[model samples]
Target: FEFIHPEFHEIVRRRLQTIIESRIVLPPVEQRLLRRDGSVVDVEVLALPFETEGGVTLQVTARDITQRRIAEAEREALEAALRQSQKLEAVGTLAGGIAHDFNNILSAIVGNTRLLLEDLSEAHPGWRSVKEIRSATHRARDLVKRLMAFSRQQESQRSAIPLAPLITEVQHMLRATIPAGIELTVRVPPDTPTILADATQIHQVLLNLCTNAWQAMPTNTGRIEISVTTLSEEAARAQSGTPLHGASHYVCIEVRDNGAGMSSETLEHIYEPFFTTKQPGEGSGLGLPVVHGIVQTHKGAIAVTSRPGEGTSFFVYLPACEAPPASFESAQRAVMRGTEQHVLYIDDEEPLVFLVQRTLERAGYRCTGEMNTARAIEIVRQAPDSFDLVITDLNMPGMSGLDVARELLMIRRDLPVVITTGYVRAPDVAAARDLGVRDVILKPDTIDELAMIVQKNLTGNR
Candidate 1:
């Protein structure tokens, strides 16, 4: 210990004694020290140092590590992100494979049974068995579809939808159901650009958030705000903890609630499926996870911020889509359009071909049916000008629907093909569109419904 200022050791000792009596360490000192050359050198000396019972002096050890700390922090953040991405990838891959196999099985059962029921009349004694089979198959089919969507395996029906309309619809529906004590508000921009998402999934996400908010505020006079606005890249990154988006354009919607908020621990685990805080039989715990999946399916990101007793907010950022082509440019309404066009329909399921032929005939279109893809292609090649449209099941044995459509197109470049399936993946749709298929119809569609789309696209009715 050195003298204080120009003072002697006695004064410094007195001050040190006082500080030590008060059980406080001496504050760090930043001063120059005399070097061997009699020149002052930059040094941070801890003066008035204390000593331990064993007589080891208490002095501060100074080291410059600001830059080191920053580099380490950055490395850690990157590693964390890589780990998360890997986990998601693994889960998504496994889920997709399982969902695909599950879907194929479902398709076989449901597709074949549907074809069978078409030939069985209501008066048939075994009709009751068929109906039961259909009912069970549908329930199982829906579950598989959900799994596929969650796993990002099922093809999304992407269309430019006005966010304002969807948000307004959801808010209006919610306001009618939510209690008066819990104020519900939707603030959407008048000119919010349309986003491409499945309409049903969007609706479900909104409903799930509203329901969760309602439960959180069972009795209180709480407030819930649903706001939609364009987000800057920085804002989106700040909320989502990633720079995965750009500042060019985005649509951000947040559901904010003034109710019992979740703890940090709960928030961290909220997106994990089946991890619920509700009592047994009270909550399914899939609501938020499904919401997470739906937003992800849209190539969007979601973030939740909460503080116990303060409130909670869930932010969803979706990329903005350009305005849709005008209504005049859209295919004409199938409900109003009449089709007299002849179609060559091919499906491995015999009953499906029969049902489709009957359906199209009833709708004024002449349909030629073939249960084999090879024979169907041969028939079309034999009479290239006979059929106006070709409708085929995308997956058929020996040759895929793509192969048949490609073969038909080679014979008749103007031929239009429509693909029907219980589930369509991204690649399947891409291949179909690449082949210039007129439309992709999800399976289990009514005959009249099928006729409408076929007529609209094939005849350019719109």
Candidate 2:
């Protein structure tokens, strides 16, 4: 049998023998036997050799497994891909969730803290401390909000906005924040086409780039320019390397800075989360990632072009908006004032309950506070129609705010309820809204604002 194919037998035997000797074990081999009749039959073999005390003997058997190997390789590749995709999905969800909750907290803190400061008197001894706390909190909150936007968890208001106005707004903010030594310029045409992006996010991107540029410049001289244009979709697709959009219908904004540019290596990972070049507490390194997230969320694309020692330019392209626009104030909603009528509030936070009581009392409304959710429910039970407004905190131990709300509304369908929570995410907003939540207030909301929302609901006017 081994001598059946004299021509190729030596080649096969030598290769098999060498493998067996090197490994000290033989696996299997496939061979083709050619007969004198000029026909070939495929043979497979497995070899095993035994050495007794006096002599040695060997036996071999082989089976064909070409199809099996192919199937196994395909299954392994599919599993690897499935695992990779799951990992990516989990990471994206975690990043987005963190950003969403963080942004909500920041927005509440910054907005209400500003109101608190305004409500405080300058002559008060603690006024300075309060102001400082407000300032710091606002700053930290802004940083967090920016990071969240970059992470893509914060909800966005979709609208068509002219690019020039947005850039001009950003330029104004930069002028106020940037050092006097830095020069800022904006060069977008007044009539640039509309693009779909969140105003707050776009502003942060410009501000971040400008601040980075100013820092990169030597002590006293560098220029920053923001420009916008309507790019053919095809043009944007070509520039981003990945097809960002179809060939002819996108808008792009570019922020160019005449400062020391980043190295290629730095540029490569600039958009990675938590990667920073600044000193401790100076930056969170989420600016670029936030930029990346925002662009991705808006169904847009972002890229940066930089030359070391020269300068850097960042280009962001977003899908052009086709719908008519709403007013900016309407787009950026403000929770409206509540009516000065009967209002009942429940909370576990003593300071918060007291604050809301005082705020509403001063506003000439009949306000009542209850720390025990059970007691509050009893009061509402005795006369659900007696109270015109209900403000309750979620996550109370015994009866959650939603439960209280459901009970109260069950007695009186017309009763208006506002749910306040520090931990509410986008999903919670919908469920709360569905549960007779006329308004959902984020925690850290000012007493005045809280009263205002309640008042608005009672008055049937926002």
Q: Pick the candidate with the highest TM-score.
A: 2
lDDT agreement of model 2 with the native: 0.70
lDDT of 1 by residue, 112-227 (tens): 56556767898999888978987787666555555556556666666778877667767877888888888888898787778777765777788888788877885757999999
Task: Give per-residue CA lDDT, model 2, range 214-292, as digits (tens).
Answer: 8777665878888778877788888876677543578777888878899998988898765777776666566787678
Each prediction's RMSD to truth: 12.6, 10.5
By summed lDDT, the worst window of 10 consecutive residues in model 1 runs over 325-334
RMSD of 1: 12.6
What is the lDDT, from 0 to 100, of the residue 401 in candidate 2?
82
Backbone clash count for every predicted candidate, in the order shown: 1, 18
Can you tell me which runs of candidate 2 are displaced by over 4 Å? 1-132, 142-154, 157-251, 255-314, 318-340, 445-448
Cα distance off (Å), candidate 1, residue 376? 7.0
The 0-to-1 C-alpha lDDT of every candidate, in the order given, reads 0.71, 0.70
TM-score of each: 0.52, 0.55
